[model samples]
Target chain A: MAKFKVLAAALGILLVLGAAAAQASGVITLEVEILPGFRISGPGSVSFGSLHPGIPEERELQLQVWSNVPWQLSANYYGTVEAPGIVEVQGRNGTWIELGSSTNLVIWDQPKTDPDGVVIKVPLRFTGSFSHDPGTYDIQIEFAVVPLL
Target chain B: MTRVILAMAVLLLVCCGQALASIAVAPVIIEADQVQAGQVFTVVCSHGGEEPLEVALSLALFDQDAWGRVILMEDEASVARAEEALSLERRRFLLQPGQSEAVQVQLAHADFQHLYAVLFLRPVRPGPSTRLAVLFLLSSGEGTPSLDLSGWEQRGTDLTITVENSGLCHGFWAGELLLFDGEGKLAEKVSVQSGVVLPGRSRGLQVSLPGWVQQVEVRSLQLGDGS
Candidate 1:
């Protein structure tokens, strides 16, 4: 009877130590890799077809942006515009801000995580006066997307 | 019947073309700490859409404004400095659908000062195209930085603190703010988001403060180890 009692106590201690050891090793560290993704796509051109004198012509272009991290979208013109015109981008509040010769920050630190991305509309307005030339006034605009850290 | 079939085929092609016209770039920001000369880094560019993409890579000096907006520097000296520090193996390349290209960038000079440059991947095709700007930050970790609280303002629940980096190297601000009431009692503790301040530049960090807070103090401010 004495031997049996000693054996029972030993087993109890062993079980307690085993449980403690198991609990210590049960902690898990989980990790996942999220590949950085940034993409942009839009139309090839915006045609403001045939301008008239003293009349304002407005055209809109839509751009799709996809990013997993914070991003900034900026626009700038490559060369001077012979015609008096202005380019504006639609803001979150539905307002438009003019884009200048220098880099203009259209969207700042906005993140779009969807795989399909989101579309943003940019509008360009120009009014040809009677004194202006009738020839084509090509204005080349460039759009750039940079990650904001 | 033949004409109808041809018209349908053309319409299908047009729809598919428009759907696949995107340019994708990965690892938008490349950072290195204690950088050494001749160290190489890689940036991958892929064409996610169906059309072939024509990409040209170039490096330019860049700086950030007080609000952290990136501004490309175009002065002669700035351009020359950027050109002397880094070089790319593949400046121009074409990527097909589902194909990617890795451009190798080798650092020629890693001075003690922090260097900021941008790799612009521009598309050759014209008319409203998208471009990707990848930022490279390199530091030798041999210089000390000076950070000072230049200004602060309160607007409703938001508290903006402007910090100036007057050192030769860039500094990162990451710490907590101790908000106290009018009686000098602790009101609330708020964490300030980490941001980079270039040398001789100031950056504004915005934090949320409790309405009853009267005084704000920076606590346990830790600067990054140039990493």
Candidate 2:
């Protein structure tokens, strides 16, 4: 009888731990059936260092992609620098593409290879103009990855 | 009838436990000291909760020494691609409960001859995601660290053991040591302190000795992954 009681008690504790973990996750996000795939990683932010007018500073933001299928990568300006001038986010695909509020283009597309997954490096040039006032100009851009199909 | 009830209860617990983490991944870190460039690999992460989860994959580079030592930056999303020639897996997906997903990571085009990346995971929220990392080690074998027992001293119930990393790489070790009293009887098992040690660095593990344990025997240490 005592052995059975111990087993029952241990089982009860395990159940409680499981229930508590479930509640912890439930309180965090939305309600949807979940699967896995699609993600983006960056250095939280991109800094162009100190720039001078007319002297374009060349920097690189390397983005890694891990999609099981062919995917298209796009970017949009989140908070535009409302200074006299905003920083232009440009990239190198087959040609030079300027990034702006409406210029969400597929700068880096995963090749239709066997795995269809890859990492891409985007070489960017940030130019500040003479009319642009400089304190510490900030620009926020959101990069998105979606299925190409 | 009692056995049936017990079996049913056990099944319920297993199901519920898996459901809790919703996102559980095995072999969290891909330690490939022997892995060469142009090698294609895959990682398997699963979902098991009642709710759907979105597991977004992201890649971050961790600068590692020649010994394949990588310090995972937890809770940090921004990873850079400078100084290292590795590419981490990045993507997002919606997963139903009881679903397993695999993502491929590459490290061929990396800058350094031997570099590593921290593959972090995030669950699209409403639910939760486990804070996990997988290390893509690009190096030749022979960088694994070796641990040596440097000193062992017992002061009362406290036993201080010194473990030194005497190799070119980092070492991770853990297990328990058997303590025997003067009467040649087993006193108790002291947890062999476990942690990672950088090359040539020494660490101390304080194991509690029950009563007066005169002899300590060391055996069966389960060495862990790239520390």
lDDT of 2 by residue, B94-146 (tens): 77878888777665553333444556555654321223445554545546677
DockQ of predictions, in order shown: 0.22, 0.01
In candidate 2, stretches whose alpha carbon ends up further than 4 angstroms from where it belongs are A1-149, B1-21, B60-71, B74-78, B81-83, B109-117, B126-130, B135-138, B142-144, B172-201, B215-227
What's the TM-score of each model vs. the native? 0.77, 0.42
Question: What's the CA error at residue B151 for candidate 2, in Å?
Answer: 3.2
Q: How many Å off is the CA of A145 in candidate 1?
A: 0.5
True contacts kept of each: 0.31, 0.00
Candidate 1 interface RMS: 10.7
Residues B1-227 of candidate 1: C-alpha lDDT, one tens digit per residue: 43222221000010112444778787788877788999998888888777787788877878988877677765678768877999888779998888999888899988657888888888766443466888887777776667777777877668888877787777676778888898999877777754777778888877777778877877646666445
